[model samples]
Target: MELELKKLSPEDGRDVYDLLQALPADENGFMNPANGLSYDQYRDWLRFAAACLEQVGVVDGKVPETIFWLYEDGRPIGMGKVRHLMTEALLEKGGNIGYAILPSARGRGLGKKFLALLASESKQLHAGRLLLTIQNHNQPSIRVALANGGRIERVTADRHYIWIDP
Candidate 1:
């Protein structure tokens, strides 16, 4: 399948949020079981996504940064976010990167490709190490991380944090 990655725009928020909302509920209306974000949290997350995209324009005075919105067959399919470096939570569990593939696009290799794209961008940022965390039971995510050279650092009930050293 052909997928294109584009810089996310504020107008993309509605579409992104709508897509996230349409995700298959895990008996709790959340895309991931490990994510305890309530409906409102999801809403806020969409807004945050938009803000992140806006920030990318001037991200530390660097224009044309590396945040991307994945499109499959010309339709929005996912979103990928890359932090310049690792944060405390990221170092511990969240990781320096995070990605979400549309529920309908899960089985495809989009997530892996997205990770590779982020990793390449992180490298440009002089990042020698990248972190990615996923829920232990999230086999697909785990597989994606592993496929992208992620080394299992540790596993927790809420997540399995992996380290990706470029």
Candidate 2:
């Protein structure tokens, strides 16, 4: 199947919201509470995403983040995020890229493809290398990272830190 990565847009709110509905609340670290918002709220979140790319908005000292969605035949299948610049906190735990394929779409090697696409996108931003952190128990995600040229940099109690040259 053909796959493409598209930057998130306000118009994509409904599709993203629907995709979120099909996923468990806490399945993917990439998704936060705001992502589960209804269409209206999600549209606001999209605006927040755009503002993040433009470096706007703040909440309790946190900044907004850029988000992208994976599409197949025009339907949303997964989502990913690229922090414009990594903060110290991100470097320690968040990493540079975060992504999640819908539950129904798992086990098809799509995660690797998704990360590959995100890596290309990160390179465009002039980032020398991308950092990705996967939970220790998420073997599938670890495989995906490895398949995309990611090398383990370190491992913490709950996560694996990987670096991929973009």
- Candidate 2 lands at a TM-score of 0.88
Candidate 1's residue-wise lDDT over 73-118, tens digit each?
Answer: 7777776666665545456655667677777777868888878877
lDDT of 1: 0.65
Error of 1 at 140 (Å): 1.1
Runs in model 1 deviating more than 4 A are 11-17, 24-67
Summarize candidate 2's per-residue lDDT along 46-92 as a digit string, tens digits.
77767667664445556456678899778899878886566778787
Q: Which candidate is the best by lDDT?
A: 2
User: What Cα-based lDDT does every candidate model obtain?
Assistant: 0.65, 0.78
RMSD of each candidate relative to the true structure: 6.1, 2.2
Clashes of 2: 0
- Scanning candidate 1 in windows of ten residues, the lowest lDDT window is 26-35
